[model samples]
Target chain A: MTEFEEIKKTLLTIYPFSEEHLKIFTDKLSLKEIKKKDFLLKQNQICNHIAFIIRGSFRLYQKTEQNELTIQFFTEKNWVSDLESLMLKQPSKNYIEANENSKIATISLLDIHNLMEIDSSFSMLNSLIANLTFPTTQISTLKLKSPDKRYEHLLLNNPDWINRFPQMQIASYLGITPETLSRVRARIN
Target chain B: MTEFEEIKKTLLTIYPFSEEHLKIFTDKLSLKEIKKKDFLLKQNQICNHIAFIIRGSFRLYQKTEQNELTIQFFTEKNWVSDLESLMLKQPSKNYIEANENSKIATISLLDIHNLMEIDSSFSMLNSLIANLTFPTTQISTLKLKSPDKRYEHLLLNNPDWINRFPQMQIASYLGITPETLSRVRARIN
Candidate 1:
């Protein structure tokens, strides 16, 4: 499939669009190849575009005084953007970096607004994407769970994450220390 | 202003709806009075409606094996619902209960879908409301901050929350113990 087709497939999964609407929507996207470890977004930058991963993965994270915290992870077919920055036009406090050599199809905030102006159906895309991608309920509740429970929840729901990301990053995402994660894994295994 | 008008005003802040569209949207909402400790939703129940708080406050929380974890708080002008449950039609794992006697204007999921079908502009309402209210960025990063920093962040951004809710609920919301919260407050004061 073409890089753009990857985007089309993802959008189709979210909302069925007529061929014409799909064409109009995908026509605005541009594809780019990114090398592993390169940043798509950095701290204090405005996230002006949302990108769909046609290949590879990315990690969204923030750097605090003491450490870098992994906020979320995205892989093939997932859309990545700081929604807060994209919506509010505020500078983002997070960084989005490619985890491996990657190809992405991206559409800018301007293009999105233009499309929304052209057709009201286009407005549903952002919300639908946000709802599907951000498991807000899970994120809010996971923090309240015990370290073992959190690890078990991840094991049950997103086992691939364990194999794909480094242990330190996964530990950061779980809000636990690397040593705690190691102990949890040993206990669970 | 009528309770429905409060909903209208909140919607206007999010998106400038045409007068006709605004009227059609607001007309579907019904006002309900909730006494303190009454639930708008409970665990295992499907959340079929999203409510706009016109008066008083509510807490969205989950009961864990060890404790109750407050996920979020909603006050006047804020919209409240288990978006995950409402969107997916899954049973909610959280509870939304009034902290004080409250009046809310709520529109059912079916009405929202009907309105979206009637006009594409109506589709923007859910996403816009979610974006304005959830503050997903803050929630993700807040977990990474130290307990004292979290309290200071709240004091700077939402001092009213400190005053309105009891120390226990706020402590739960912050994912800290009440004793820790007292120490944080004492240190800051």
Candidate 2:
């Protein structure tokens, strides 16, 4: 099956969708390629589109007055959208940037509203958004609630992330400083 | 309209649901009464149900070795469920208790899954969980990232919360100490 077909299959696997329902989504979406370091989105810009990464890597981050913090990372077969800014139709305080040259498909919020109105199955799609976003934040929140356990768990679960991301970025994502992370790593080893 | 009707309306407003969909939820749910300081859910027990508070307040917390930390709180018209424990169907690490004498409606996870299968509109219901849980942690994480701004923003946005929640709980939720919150409040006032 093609990437488009995969998109429908992947989405429908998580949500129950019919052919007509899938067609509504495919019709409203456009496939695009983004180069490494190219932005899929930026801070202070309005996030009107929600993009699903078909392949490649992207990181969503926020720039606060003190420093930049990595909120989340997205890779192949994952959806990355600033839901707060996108749903509210406000300027995003977050930036989503490609980490590697990437290809993604995106659908506008207006199209989503239209699809939800036209197709009943799209209601399940809304749940898909909730479920997808919930776990992403849940994992981070779980980690933040208990940084020591989280650091140990992360090493056990996804050591690759340690090697893939910069220490400072990972530190920010973990809600800790680079020095703390380094100390934790050293003690664990 | 009845309280159930209000709930059904809220559900449909976010994602349209049919009569059959609404019936499925009401059929499986039952209203429950909880007294102030009563345990709606307890640590180390399997979280078998999700409760929606129709009246009164509730709090979910975890006990660390040194202190008990408030993970979340819910007022009237809010839902409370241990997402991680509920989804995993494991012994919960947190406890959800009534802050004030409360009346709640609850449904079992099994029943919810049945509802999900029977009608897709329930998916949006799952997404709404974050509406209650995220703000606390999100504010805390923001405070961790940019303490001054988030503190100022919180004071500006919900000045009443300072008076509503205990100082220690507010400080813990903000990932700060009571002394620090006192200092911060002083500076703000």
Candidate 3:
């Protein structure tokens, strides 16, 4: 399907709106191609737009005193945005960068709020966030419970990610050392 | 406000529903009270109900071979139910117990499903999960970046919790040891 068509499909999936309402949202969003290593968001920048990945991947990370830690990776058809920063209109402490040549459609926070006001159906958009993003947040808490179990579960569900993302990034995401990840891989194999 | 009145306000805060719709949900939910240390849910039992804590405090914990860990806690007016175990209809691996005398209202999964089908607004309930419970999840993931930072942030946000919850439980939630937590608290104070 065409990128525009795919975006329309996704919007409808979350909050079904009339054709005109859909057009309002689609019109506001512009698809942009980002080259690998391009920065989508930078530390201390207010992330004004939420990008929906049409093609390619992105990583959200933060640099600590010791290391650059990868917190999450968003691949094709996934949403990647600094939610807290976007919501609070504060400068983001984290960074989001393109991992591969990617195509993403961008929507500004103002546009989303406008759409929510225009489309009553969009009111349930919060439901989408609650269901998709909330559980993901829960996964973080779950990870603290058992790192090895969390790692095993991640591999079981997204085995492809291990090959797609760098080992260092994966280790950061898993809250472990790259050396430890290698050892874990060896043991599992 | 009365417990019944508070339920209406909370429900409407997420989705505006008719008084009739509100009654249907409250009807399915039955109220109960538990003393401190009483089990709301126990390990090895099928958790059949999704409960709302109207008053007091409770926590969900899982025991490892080495230690018993607190996964999460709930205070007044929070939803305290295991989504995985409840949704999957499996025996829970964790136990949820009251930390103090608590008043709760609970509804079975079957009833909630029935309520959803009866009122489309209930389908929008997922956002409630996202906003109310998902932040804890997000914080959990974010904490993986820095355990020390997480502990500091927790203290800043929920000062009373330190006194309310056991030192060991707070340690597990922070992904640290009891000794580390004690030391951290000592340093902070």
Candidate 4:
């Protein structure tokens, strides 16, 4: 099936949205092709759009004085955005980059508002996507003590993300230095 | 105005409802009187309800071997719940406790679903509250280096909460040790 078909399918599964209403909603979406390492969003910019990955993947990260910390990863059938920045209309502190050649359906927060205004189903979908952005930050990180535990947790719960992104990025996501991550990997082996 | 009246006013302002619809809605909520430091939610339990603070404050925290960490604080007019755990129907890893002799309007997730079935206004209100649970987990905490910086961010953005809770709890919320927090406070003074 085409990426757009996958998009429509997910929307339909999210709610049995009427095809006419779905068409009316999806028609407003602008599609984009992003090359690897190209930024979908940058720190200090007010993020205006949220996109759903149709073909590839992206990484969300923050660079501190020490190193870049991976915040989130998004792939096919998943959505990505600096959600708070989009909602608050404030500057973002992270950079979101294409991890592979990617295809996504993009919609601005204004368009989302218009769509929500147009239909209750769209509003419900908006709420679902909002819930999705939240789970990443709500739990873990602060509770976990070691990179080993965090790495194992990721392997158990989100191995797909680990497989898709580079090891260095994974190290960052686990909040450990790359050398430390290498030592952890060797110990595991 | 009474807390119930305040709730009604906020709901009406959020999305206008007919008196009958308001009756259907408010009827699902029960008044809860909580003593200071009483647990509203406990770790490992499924958080069944979301409560709106009517006349007091609450703190959300997670206990670890090292120490108990205060994660979030909620006050009057705010809603509190282990939202993700409630949504997932899973055990929570945090506790929520009253910080005052609080009066709250509490509704179960089942009731929220029933309310959604009854009105589009309830659906919109659910979406609004869902958005509220997200901004906390969204940005800046990991990137900020110093306890001093985090304290300042709190002072600037959430001074009301800082003044309401104990210093040790505030330190935990900042991911800092209390001794360091005291020193930071002394330096500031």
**Which residue pairs collide, candidate 3?**
A130-B130, A137-B137, A137-B138, A138-B137
Candidate 1 on A1-189: residue-level lDDT in tens? 467776777677767888899899888888899999999999899988998888899998888788888888888877888776776667998899999999988888778767776776676575544553445555554556588988888898889989999999999888788999999999999
* Minimal lDDT window, size 10, model 3 chain B: B129-138
When just chain B is superposed on the true chain B, each candidate scores a TM-score of: 0.93, 0.85, 0.88, 0.90
- lDDT, residue B165, candidate 2: 70
Model 1 CA deviation exceeding 4 Å by range = A2-6, A109-123, A135-142, B2-8, B18-21, B109-127, B135-142
The DockQ for candidate 2, computed on C-alphas, is: 0.18
Weakest ten-residue segment in model 2 chain B by summed lDDT: B131-140
Best prediction by lDDT? 1
TM-score (chain B) for candidate 2 is 0.85
lDDT, candidate 3, residue B96? 91
Better of 1 and 2 by DockQ: 1
Candidate 2 — which residues are off by over 4 angstroms?
A: A5-9, A16-28, A44-48, A88-90, A117-119, A135-150, A179-189, B1-32, B40-54, B63-67, B77-94, B104-130, B136-154, B177-189
**Candidate 2: tens digits of C-alpha lDDT, residues A1-189:** 288886887787667777877877888888899999899888789987877788888887887678777777777777788766665456877788888899999888667756655654565555445444543334335425556776876787667778877888778777778898888888878
What is candidate 3's lDDT per residue for B1-189, written digit by digit as tens? 379888778788777888988888888889999999999889888876877888999988787677776777889877888755654456888889999999999888667655555555575454444333434334434546466677877878777788999888898777677898888878778
Instruction: State residue A102's C-alpha deviation in candidate 4, in Å.
Output: 0.6
Per-residue lDDT, model 2, residue B118, is: 55
As a whole number from 0 to 100, the lDDT of residue B183 in candidate 2 is 86
Better of 1 and 2 by TM-score: 1
Alpha carbon lDDT of residue A26, candidate 4? 77
- lDDT per residue for candidate 4 within A80-183, as digits (tens), equals 89876765567988899999999889878767666665555565565445545654332345434477877777877788987688889887666566798788
